[model samples]
Target: MIITDTHTHLYSEAFEADRDEMIQRAIDAGISRFFIPAIDSTYSERMLQLKRDFPEHMFLMTGLHPTHVKDDFKDELLHVQTLLKEHKYYAIGEIGIDLYWDQSTLAIQQEAFRQQIQLAKQCNLPIVIHCRDAFDEVFEILEEEKGDDLFGIFHCFTGDFEQAQQAISYNMKLGIGGVVTFKNGKIDQFLNKIDLKHIVLETDSPYLAPVPYRGKRNESFYIMEVLEKLSGLYQLSEKEIAKITTENSKAIFGI
Candidate 1:
């Protein structure tokens, strides 16, 4: 019944007051694997410290997030590249265009996304995409870059069935999270149509918490709530859903 949270900011300051206890709750619930995504250089030091503290449980990824892409994005990309070269990370990820925050940064966001995708290709690592309000633009770039070498997880995916198929076409595994538990989340209606193999579980904690905890600060332990929801959607037991999605995470992260 081992569960893997493929997308979580366990190092986030949101859990500063009780980080250890919060993580312990997940561990006790069988959510052992935590894949931490990099936002930028600002969180790099903290991310590394988390890895050091939980080496066996934590897998780190290095990349500049879309919303964090600003005027000095080039330098940030360089920092990501330097980290990739000097250290080992599971993926180049949580990177993509995020027009939800600021449409003005679209040009730079696209450039950063493309550059990071190229870097992922060079490193032979999968990417963890963070698309928001820019699916068309993101797909356009993915179209230009699609190939045997391009593969990754569409992190925190909440797209339609057709869009889900489209992401799968790009060799992406859809990352299902707390949103699936929401009454109006929508994706739950057709999620069973997509095979579990094409799906991975996540919480995106300190963000999109599941029902019972919706709108509240999310944590990894709440991933179990997500698992329970999937169990119903797929007509499988919680253990089975955990196993399938953990395997799916392994397939993407290569853990």
Candidate 2:
């Protein structure tokens, strides 16, 4: 099974001590594809080095994350634009409004999100969104920008059935992660109702670790826990879930 982790900060300092061993562990467990999202210009070199180290498995994206948007956001966007011109990226993402961190930055966050969406349209690339405590806000912008040309994954989606359907209406595949394995992570309640085609697997590793590993640092190999949970929720075999979700990832990332 070729599992795809559509969003993971594999370049995160969390794995600095044993990055290679950690990645190899995932590869040995069949989690081969890793889509790395850009946070800011600061991590660009580390992302590039990761790609070089594991060229076959790593796919890169370029964008300024919502939480990272600040007074110097315009310059950061320029850096993203310049990176786009210089490198081949799979998407423009991990970008969107994140009001949970600092509601005060809402105005600039909205502007950055809108600009990045436009940039994604210009490049004909999918966008991976990072939305938190801003579903209404994110949907509002998506409502304004909806079209055949705008399509991508709603990274780490945590919303109700209505919001899930709305996200689908915008050509977004719901990115199911470790949260699905949590006892109280509500997405599992209505996930089966949504077709498997509309879903993709992820770990958001070193972050939202699945149960049995919850409250601990997550790794790509731990995505197996998520796969097992999804298998039960969807009434499919683990291999089948992996195949379908990996295919869904391909559909979004064009890999």
Question: Which is the leading candidate under lDDT?
Answer: 2
Q: Which ten residues in a row have the lowest lDDT in candidate 1?
A: 245-254
lDDT of 2 by residue, 1-255 (tens): 899999899999999999999999999999999999999999999999999999999999999999999999999999999999988899998899998889999999999999999999999999999999999999999999999989999999999999999999999999999999888999999999999999998889889999999999999999899899989998999999999999998988889
CA lDDT for candidate 2: 0.94
Tell me the TM-score of model 1.
Answer: 0.99
Question: What is the TM-score (0 to 1) of candidate 2?
Answer: 0.99
Residue-level lDDT for 210 in candidate 1: 96
Residue pairs clashing, model 2: none
Error of 1 at 70 (Å): 0.8
After superposition, which runs of candidate 1 have C-alpha atoms over 4 Å from their true positions?
none
Residue 53, model 2: Cα distance from true site in angstroms: 0.2
Give the deviation of candidate 1 from the true structure as CA RMSD. Answer: 0.7
For model 2, how big is the CA root-mean-square deviation? 0.6
